[model samples]
Target: MTRAVVLVTGPDQLALWQPLLTGTERTSAAPVVLRRHDRRSLRGWAQRVEMFHKEDRLERLHELTGGWPLLVDQAHRLHTELDDPDEVLRRLAGLRTDLTRAREFADAAGVYADPLLAAGYRELDKEFADGSFDWENTVTAVALGGELEEDDAHRVIACLDALQVFDRDGVELRLEPLLRECVTLRT
Candidate 1:
């Protein structure tokens, strides 16, 4: 008989699951280059995090995508799934009509909303420009992962006015399927 035990440690489990690049099994899962984080990395990350409250700069977030809106729309769709999936799908017909008529951003305004969202959107813009928008996972990684907080859910709606990346009418927002696939990698 065997029982499952939870192991708690400060090491990266992804790294632990495979051999290092310098180790024998080069064909194993890809190696994460972070041998150890220096104070600069730690401090820089800390600074960014602290600043997130003061000025998140998002470094992730985008409501409006310039061209090939497919990816952006898909991301919005994915975000909707994160919401009450039943409602999103069930009320989508009515919501689409109402959203198309609405003129306001979806959520309440917050202090760091625009900056944080811009950070996310700008990255998306860059990716789109670089032709990387075709990959959904990259967009999701930028928007939902890396210091992403549940609180961020509210802020995205709050900063809508300034973001202007989403549909003004609100009917077109969505997330791509590829991004959804990438989300599993995080867990």
Candidate 2:
């Protein structure tokens, strides 16, 4: 027997792959979700792109991106193309100080360009329109006083995860800092 491992990656895995797989195939498939890179993996990616010269700058990149691959790649591209990459990183890292600056950075990064992420953002924005959500709270709180069924809450959480809007540590879910800033600023 030949054994093969297939990896499926996209903004929405279910939407991308579900239609093609039969019910038994879907049930038998073992899915492994890939999360953001860590410092080590970030270093590896940076080295491959020949952007690993400055230790401090690399650390700053890690901090700013939280290992989010798209943001990291964007930062790397800006780093290579721009005369002063530090200034760019500095501005993005300091977005918390100015709402306008945050919006500009978010726009430049094409944060909502991905359809799945845009949909997730819209869902989150609609759910937490007041811009007051407790990150430490469970997904049940996302339902907002039982408005959504338990399955709906799970689906929402799954969608957010697929969009990389938040990081899940065991049972806890914390929104990505940069995304949180952008979302809150928009609200």
TM-score of each: 0.22, 0.63
Using lDDT as the measure, which candidate wins? Answer: 2
- lDDT scores in order: 0.32, 0.60
Q: Output the number of the TM-score-best candidate.
A: 2
Q: Residue-wise lDDT of candidate 1 within 23-112, one digit each (tens)?
A: 435553443332212223433543543321122221221212122123224434644455542333333223223433121112211112
| Candidate 1: segments with Cα more than 4 A from true spot | 1-114, 127-142, 161-163, 168-170, 174-187
Count of clashing residue pairs in every prediction: 23, 0
lDDT of 1: 0.32
The TM-score of candidate 2 is 0.63
**Candidate 1 TM-score versus the reference:** 0.22
Provide the lowest-lDDT 10-residue window in model 1.
Answer: 103-112
